[model samples]
Target: MAGRKKTFHGVSVGILMVKTGFRRLPGDVGHAGTWDFPVQYRVVEGATPDKMMALESSGLLDEFKAAALDLVAGGVDGIATTCGFLALYQRELTAACGVPVASSSLLQVPLAHRLIAPDKRVGILTFSRESLHASHLEAVGVAADTPVEGMPADSVFVTAIKSGDTVPRFEAMRAEVLQAAERLLGSHPDVGAIVSECANMTPFSADIAERFGIPVFDGVSLINWFQAGLRPRRYPQA
Candidate 1:
């Protein structure tokens, strides 16, 4: 392969981060420690969690595109975002960046749907159930009727993320996430798998999976799969 024009090398993914002050735990996509492979990050100023929830009117698509282009110039093989709601811009970002872009973990929903039993369905746990509309799911090839559950509006998980709490209550946040999962499973007993729509929820994916006895897919899972394709491992010949 021909060498590409890049300021740096060896980074396979460039993560476009929303500007926020929330504490990013180890499993969060924004945290460097969450990834086994090195990743580059570019923060899109003014892209807050609230604005991202209503991305269609956020007027930040251009800003996100510009940031992604900048990451490509800096040498990332692909693009990703810290917000799952960015799935709305999947087509635009992929076109603008001229590289593979996994804009949201929700992109895995269609595949998750296929991985489960014919009668079973994939459920979503999001930051705001109301904000996640049909267009967002349709953009990613997910069924508009897919079951979805959100953290309570006043729950610690939603509050900390929206307020950008620098000192988040980890246990409280975990509990809220688990409760949301429980609600999802309770309402839709046929949910064979789950896709976490908030990047911050990645930390509790294991707990959700273990507690609910269902497969949980989140930002980490999406990015790891994205990275594998960008830099597949090689086996030495015997």
Candidate 2:
């Protein structure tokens, strides 16, 4: 009746996290309060924000693969990561672990493109424009010329997040995010949707949408959607 013996576990998703001590707000993928389903997390010891944002993430591939494998061993049906830049490692991670891997919110770009008209494209709001290279986008099947906007390097959000502050200036961060969103939209008038590439920006997604009147997608929505497919709702038969 079955292939290899498989076990059922409570958790539906295993989140591979970067090694950082930052305070995760309610909307962050790393924050437990962000999910409606049971989930597990494993931090790749040396995969800090700096390392993750680096131009090349291949060096940390083995570390991330090991952590993801451990999560699979723990019985998680699917795996995800807390950073969008990990999009570059998507192929390797998925290959190393025999499970569905949703490594980056940027993966939503191609889907978002279908939701809007061809003339209107999806815009990306990332933590660092310089770091979100063509390889990252290409790895996830997104176009290299996709519109992208990055948080100001000196902004409060970037400063707090990179510093790993347990108690970040939320208001300051919100302002910074809103400002970034505005700048992105202003520069790219043809953008029909905004995709937040930073996992921590999920908390502000609602506000961004409300203010801009456009759908805003992030890691939270991506992973939640991915998990819903893995563990679908059971309805009563009519």
**What's the lDDT for all of these models?**
0.92, 0.89
lDDT of 2: 0.89
Backbone clashes under 3 angstroms, per model: 0, 0
**lDDT string, candidate 1, 1-238, tens digits:** 2488889899989999999998989899999999898999999998988898889899999999999999998898899999999999999988898889999999999999999999999999999999999989988898989999988889888888788889957899898899999999999999999999999999999999999898999999999999999999999999
Clashes of 2: 0
Instruction: Report the lDDT of model 1 for residue 50.
Output: 81
Worst 10 residues of 1 by lDDT: 1-10
Question: Deviation in angstroms for 152 in model 1?
Answer: 1.2
Which of the numbered candidates is closest to the native, going by highest TM-score? 1
Candidate 1 global lDDT? 0.92
